[model samples]
Target: MSAAPESPAERQAIDRLFNPRSIALVGATERSIWSIAANDNLRRFDFKGSIHYVNPKGGTIFGAPAATSCAAVGAPIDAALLMVPEAKMIDVFADLEAAGVGGAVILSAGFAELGENGAERQRAVAAAAKGAGIRILGPNCLGFANFVAGAPIWTTPLRRPMADARVAIVSQSGAIASQLEQFAYQQRVGVTHMISTGNEADITIADAIDYLARQPEPRAIALFLESVRDPARFAAAVQAATAAGKPVVLLKVGTSEATARAAQAHTGSLVGDDRIFDALCRKLGLSRVHSLEELIVTADLFARLGPVECEGLALTAMSGGMCEIMTDQADAEGIAIPTLADGTLKRLREALPPFATPANPLDITGAAMLQPDLIPTALAALASDASVGALGFVFDAPLKDDARGFARSFIRHIGEGFKAAGKPCVMMSHTFSAVNGEAREMTDSAGVIYSGGGVRHGVSALGHLAAHHAWRRRAAAAADNVPAAAGTTNAARPNGERDVLDYLATAGVPVIPARLARSADEAVAIALALEANVVLKIASPDIAHKTEVGGVALNLRGEAAVRNAFDTMLARVREAAPAARIDGIVVAPMRQGGVELFVGTMNDPQWGPAIAVGLGGIWVEALKDTSLRLLPIGEQDALDMLAELRGTKLLDGFRGAPAADRQALARAIVAIGQAALALGPDLVSLEINPLLVDGARVEALDGLTEWKESE
Candidate 1:
């Protein structure tokens, strides 16, 4: 984890930057939309702090006398909103510093994002702020609003601060931040803070997370990230948030493999930026969502429910079609709607009509319309089920007909049932809709936790909820059970196939026994000693794919066959890759009829060491089916990776082959990761492909290492 501010002074400055008692709006004007919105928000939030608007022209703004500049305001400002153009920042910072400004939010564009010239200008601005001992929030971005503190320094229009706000939003894009806030409001999810870190000149998303995790109001944090500047800092912030019980729901943009780096091995070529991020999310237990709606909805659910103790979610709906839809969605989301306990099923059967059959996604049918009491009855029955962790019910919230209070009784009964059930519960709409004031009031008064995201997004949130709990548990266990490190002792740089396998063996990884053969006679002698059919391959540090160069001959028997194969392979490799240094032939007993597994370790520049495992050979690349996790992984983590593979059935002894020993395979994988870590950072990757597993025997068939330039 990354280290943070080392002193209380730094902590206090961050606190004052977001929740200041006094602020100055430099360059405030009545005509500009930004000025108008910023002023409007202060009034809307009933900001009690001193709000000083400054203009060099200085006459009147917002019906109050405007100061000529912050210096003229004659008071120390805890935070200053600089709304001037970039050309005038030099003088603006002078005036801000004169007034003892603690933090500055630059609301101008044309810096850092425009090219080299803009980057230079941004640097000058940063230097000026630093010289003045002031922290900067943005040099090109929207400002923030602290609703909990009634401080609105934002430059966009907003609805009233959400009551009982629990979710906080922080984004790299101001425009995206605005969209997220509007969507959160539409979903009736209250927000405590909305921060945008434009260009991240001084204060970045990592800093915001570090600060917000310690704040009291936000129950969950929703992030929209384009990039991270400091990975270690970001990781530390995430760890802090997780420890605080503040679930972080992430929405990142890049997923296309277009950004993947070209490398010499399959592991380096296949591991992309997004997959590494996904591995990071698993390590930190973050709820990573794909779209904007998913981001807000998942965060809302996370705020309502943290780590869950139970494993399943119990759902009910009044219509059979809605029940079917929910069931399908549950399956797609990997959410368990477990079978109802026998006692709970009996109770549900007793309460429902004779036609109703009790099941997981209980279908109350049309009987719920007349008998609203059935809502509570079903809730009580489902809540008692051992597998259920949470409950959800599907019913479209009234758009306008609710004026007659038609659904009031139904909502009231459901809410009362939820309160009595003593478990987290939410009522979702059958379709996506808006939650207007009246609808919000109805749910609030009846004590119903409500969502207007409808079935798709609502069920997706429950899926995220389950994943959040599972990830948290797994992450915790991984942290606690980290394998102790034993430094590698075999060699400094293990490059050739034999050398790589030898290094792995020192780390307790099982490797196929092999000896280097300088001549066909030596190769034949080694094959005879094994008393088994042998495989011969030309070993060269430069040649990664020995088979592609006609350098490999497998399943050779007898003296003539072994000798002929060795000679032919050497001649082919020397011709194909003449500059390569040949390490003769690697002769190992050919053990066939077993499952092949791919275990590789890659040292990501930003995330450090990580391991990936998948079906061996072509599937590792063709299917792109693999599971990745950060290094120092436990045996259980390896088992989990194997279980996640698309071709996992092949490991269960497909066809006539013996069942591959999963426990032994997992142990070998753990050792492989430890071996990679021991090689240190200069080694780019270590791959053990076709780690042939036949029953309880697991051995590395062939291995290679790619190293970076030595210091």
Candidate 2:
């Protein structure tokens, strides 16, 4: 089977499944209590669409008339929910297709996710659906349901009715998907769509996201993915979401090697290459959450508050000790809580009592909670200040009667005030059980994300959210133009040193002039023509590490020095590598520069071509500093690549030395990436070690390339 082309009309038709005019439940039966429960939920949620049940058993399901099959259904069916066994799914899909069904959600298992035989069966099902021009959601999936449309295709029965909100969840795991639904229900958070992309035999999480992005309801998307089958497609979907102003929060399940292996074994999907996946996510501007709880909380915040445009945050707590702890947390997470400006400080000082300190993370005495509106007043003053980007409130449980009322009133007032001011605010309290029922209700109704257990978790969550916002804005502004492709050429070079020079020069990398000589007389003539101190080294493709075998002799001043070093180097190399074939001597002018650098390219087994840049010379191993980026990177991205290196400070005039030419380095890196991308995996590795970088110039001192056997 060939890959299918994107069809805009077909995608639109697929969208109707989430908001169908009428639905037919094929193979619906009383014995399938799960299906019956879903039907009951539709009615309970006051679904406006018509529901048709097709069961040969001929009984009423949730008081709806049951048709024997799709042929007997009199009304037009927009979508069909199939709950039959795997063997009967193909026929059911065919019937639905004949009925002009726009989409079908298969609730059965035993497809590609099961094993080899199941994979073949899944292929056959996909082929049949494609031939009929029907969009099939799943063969081994839990099915999807839109809470906004009151669609009742979900496998698990929803205990609570759906609330209207801006968060949509899509998960590969059925259990996780159900858990998200329940979590939202418990928190009274609104959900637009909940999907479990089981097996992903045809429709994937990316496809679902693309569909959801068109909906005007959802402001954010939360994803739970064990593996990404098509990274390019996923990245495109994420980009689309970002363009639509919908933030995507991802909970990636497989972190360790064991977990990755287990995911593959369980689902027949690859999951181990986390580095490439992370790079893809970062490039595409996706928020990565570590845990399930964090996923919901962050989604809730993003959905309710929208994007916050603050440079730094202001933290306030009832206890001074808690403020100190939060300081450490903020420092470790790289969250900036700058000192209060003079004007803002004066306003805060005036608003609070005499003992209150006007600083970032202002710690009011515990007695302040006794005042009915003290916390909210402080938050309002801080949020109104232009210097504050966000506000954090911390306190123990509101125990006193007045304190409890004050907590409820303050949360309600602050929530409304933040909404009006368009600022983000978070609340932290250890008095989870002490708050009155009314106060708890106020907290929930206001949509405030709270952490009662620990300060670190709360601070970390806020810091991550803030960083994500910052990174997204930056990535959005970064240049996205694709770099021009570099053309290939063949150059004549009989020896290793000449070949290195030829290749580097062809790629616009400056290199020292070099020549190959069969005898010492030829080496002397070449050195005279170069008119500088020359270096001579034994040139042999078979010799990988030349210095180890005494094959290199540097800085030959004249004829006598060149002749003696040439003879000694060749003899030592021949003795060291007896079986190695030998090439004669390579003579080159000595190169001098400000700093030494290494740039190399390697083909990753999973991510294809990638480039690496690092500090060179003796400190290479000691520093172990390097930065890697996927190949075919743009020139601006190349600059970013260089800046990511840990030793980048050295290039920027460290220790009062002249700064190296960053633009020159970026150009060289881009050139290397173009070459690697063109040659592909056939060129195994390319290295330019000790590349000299001066004030505004760069030169490749030495380089090597390994080629693969022709196919």
Which candidate number would show the highest TM-score if scored against the true structure?
1
Which residue pairs does candidate 2 place in steric collision? 397-431
lDDT, residue 614, model 2? 75
lDDT of 2 by residue, 1-711 (tens): 012445886786687777788888888776777687667777776778888888877778667788888768877888888888888777776677668888888878888877899999999988887776777787777788777777767767775444457789999987898898777665455688888888887788888888888889888898999876665667677777878988888899764343243222211121124644565566666777787766766676667655667558888887788888889879876687877778778877887888878777888666464663565666776777776777777743343437446555656654554454457777766432333434445676766544442455556656666767776666556556546444444433223656776777876777767888888889888888888888887788787667889987877788888888888888898899988777688888876547887777765444455566778755555675666666667667777767877678878886777898898888877876776555544665676766778777787777777665467
Alpha-carbon lDDT of model 2:
0.71
Give the candidate number with the greatest lDDT: 1
Q: Give the TM-score of candidate 2.
A: 0.83
Tell me the TM-score of model 1.
Answer: 0.96
TM-score of each: 0.96, 0.83
Summing lDDT over every window of 10 consecutive residues in candidate 2, give the lowest-scoring window.
Answer: 263-272
Report lDDT per candidate: 0.85, 0.71
